[model samples]
Target chain A: MTSAAQLTQAQDRFIAVWGQMAGAWGVSRTMAEVHALLYITGEPLCTDDVMERLQISRGNASMSLRALLDWAIIERAHKRGDRKEYFHAEQDVWTLFRAIVRQRITREVDPLLASLYEIRDMTAIDRKRARSDNEDLRERIDIHNQRLESMLEFFQTLEQLAAMFISPAGKGLQAAATLLSKSPREEAAP
Target chain B: MTSAAQLTQAQDRFIAVWGQMAGAWGVSRTMAEVHALLYITGEPLCTDDVMERLQISRGNASMSLRALLDWAIIERAHKRGDRKEYFHAEQDVWTLFRAIVRQRITREVDPLLASLYEIRDMTAIDRKRARSDNEDLRERIDIHNQRLESMLEFFQTLEQLAAMFISPAGKGLQAAATLLSKSPREEAAP
Candidate 1:
């Protein structure tokens, strides 16, 4: 039988790896560690439990839990006849990924897209003004405007693609896999 | 014509926004700012230019530039009869994204997949050891192993999809858009 020590070791390793993965993706290590603990335990754990298991401070545990809650990847749970609030992670990896992706699109991509549109509009107006001033400056603005337009198109397309992937009937990953399995190279050979 | 002051203001705003976006994605603000500067200028810039324009220390600029170069989104260039090394961004947004994605897949996803596989194997061995000694321990290990397998499958599928998208003739973005536009719901309806 696997000893209790072995079990603890395995859990610790998993949490550490998960924490590193989250760090690479721009998430706080503590937040990722908290989620990893909950996920590996497959049970609701209180902040005290998290603190004990991860060797983190009370405030750190509390903040990590709150951040996870904000990300919608973890939830507060009430144990039967227990006063301490516990937490559990959304076990489905795909759903968790979708939530993160959705949040990033709204928080980061949307703002960038809006800014790009504004910049493009402003540059276009400036381009018009520069046309009759100096040929060199006008040409420079023209190139810049073209690049901005291309960049805007790229982001717009990317946003549309992300939305489609996250749609209910998307099955995007599955569909892409199927398409890839069909061998595009042979079709393109002609 | 738009005055130089206005142009500088717009560039500064764009760089600031770009830095924030990069931070969300786990890149340093300075690295993103440097790339943004080069991207906007559409021209190569030396270390001094980047330092002066961004108001960053020489060491900070050098480090950020080196990091960007490592990511392959920027390249070092030399001016004729000049010893100073200038850097330029990829300029093409699609190409820039491809470079970033490629680097991430190599540096992050590949290592993660390897570790998950190792963890799964270790858990499986432990599950076997527990089966004859303790039923409860075995069951718990089994559940953990199952979760690990599911997680592994999820990552494998993601890696496969990433590979296909990055393959030659993939036209990944356009292809995804086309697939999404076809209305999978209607196709699935009886």
Candidate 2:
């Protein structure tokens, strides 16, 4: 096959893999495919380019591009004297990863933490109202409180870790990468 | 409301929140609800208990329980003179998190990494076979290779981090927690 054909084949495989794996990561397949197309080609692509290449509906391509913009992984690029608005993906992998994490945290983690806190506070009011003579009820409340606290603590830690990774200073991701790359013994050594 | 009634309400809310959040984390709603029910109640429950509490069909309950067991977050329990099998969730939050990461890595990350490797290998063969006179094709292939390598490196780093977190020596998780909890300045001090 020609080199151009080989290149197209590789790009197709990359897009296919990305689309397939997206569901496992809680992302839409089409959205990932759109992003993969932009990233793999390393070129500014308009809605027409996206629709034509992916064979997706115009509305679907537009929505995916809009969502990718909201996620901050892709941005609008302009060409002089051109009427069409083109989109470009953040080519730096670290930036892309951080942007995705930041988006997920905002969309998913924040609401989860809020719900956990709401539950805890709601239950706290109930815990205080229990009759003193009801030992069984009190014990059950304690257990419930403990379970909620455990979950809250775990999620809170995760939130902190995410914040560190995506902080503006940006040393956290590199530090974490270095630390995690070390063996157990190496990491453990003082 | 009575303390028992309040407890039930709390459990119900917890289950709902977990079920809703499960989709964001790529888990089934019913499966998360089943796990939440077992976990919040802190009791070894039979299939009957799960079915009645979740108001799900027997098949759904059985499937969710089986999946929870497969994820290693829940396990079978036996009671004296009881013919029915009971299931229990891992109560410790850290253990639960580790188990989940391990399961996701096996199911999602492992396959993703394999696909990436396959793509890289396949493209490498194509690159070698490309005609030397075609500079444009060579450059395109080079760009494709670079993109794949960057992604591979980032994911490989993530895999190592996950491995550290789930390693049996058990220091990795705690150490990472401590490291992440530190301010950037404090972490950089040593």
Candidate 3:
């Protein structure tokens, strides 16, 4: 059992650190802190552990964990002696990053693709003429949407490959340049 | 300068996509769409375009622009012909991503270092005793902080080099793994 003082101190420290992190990355403070808690728990923890450690509600824990699961950061784990389901972070940050990249592609890029197809298939010329204004709008969207989707698909695959550390070396990084997201130059600089 | 129809289309398309995009990523709908607009606009735009296209308030446009500027996705532009400081995206999406990654490293990772140092310098016996729970917590935080800092520093440099795309394909991505972010997967995944 940890002291109330010590636990609160740790929670405060995490909350402070995570606030800056949340704003920077677009994640919320509570979400980042909750993720940070599970990330550092050092073992798979149940809903109770999350609630106790972070002092959040069970419903909130479920929501945030589901969110993280969507990000693919935390995954399910069942300890040897325990029946309750637990969750832990993928410690290899790259692997964790890969899961997120992949999930984001599926959730973000795929839906964009669906939206593009739907708009592109709009064939009523009378409607198009009547809404040429809207048609013009849709056309530009189709153009840019295709571009982003093409780029994002490539990026997601490379991230998966990178997590595997496969196809090796500069190939993964070069993937960044020709079709990948982010610059190879930036990767090399730091 | 774009036509009213063209701008409307661009604005509508982006606003719709941004909402979906924001949900997948941690960013807000307005923030994502704002970035999207900046990405495709051939020339720099001012707050007016942002408001006109999205039908947002002047204050809302200003606030969102400030947020994007903070995120490093959008920048204030000063063209030779124009006195009004227009805003523009970095254009290269990958380059933009690199800048965001770097900024996040500075905001999120750098501050943690300061906190750990302060925790280390804690003078209270309660704070200093290694066996004490507080000290144990502090020490754990320190180690995590160090690992994160080192990782962020390494990746930040790697991203810089990768951004340049200077490394020739023959030896580039191959060289990036050791020279870039080192994934801990020692054994090649079979």
User: What overall lDDT, based on C-alpha atoms, would model 3 receive against the true structure?
Assistant: 0.59
Model 3 misses residue A3 by how many Å?
11
Tens digit per residue, CA lDDT, model 2, B43-73: 8999999999999999999999998998999
Strongest candidate by DockQ:
2
- CAPRI accuracy category, model 1: acceptable
What DockQ does predicted model 2 obtain?
Answer: 0.62
Error of 3 at A172 (Å): 8.8
- Candidate 2: lDDT over CA atoms? 0.87
Interface RMSD of each: 2.8, 2.0, 8.8
Interface DockQ per candidate: 0.45, 0.62, 0.14
Best by TM-score: 2
What tens-digit string does per-residue lDDT give for candidate 3 at B46-83? 88888887778898888888988887778888879877
Q: Candidate 2, which segments miss by more than 4 Å at Cα?
A: A175-190, B128-133, B175-190
lDDT of 1 by residue, A27-132 (tens): 7888999998898778899999999999999999999999999999999999889999999999987778777877778887899999987776666567556646
Output the worst ten-in-a-row residue range by lDDT, candidate 1 chain B.
B176-185
Candidate 2: give its CA RMSD in angstroms. 2.7
User: Which residue window of length 10 is worst by lDDT in model 2 chain A?
Assistant: A179-188
Computed on alpha carbons, the lDDT of every model, listed in order, comes to 0.79, 0.87, 0.59
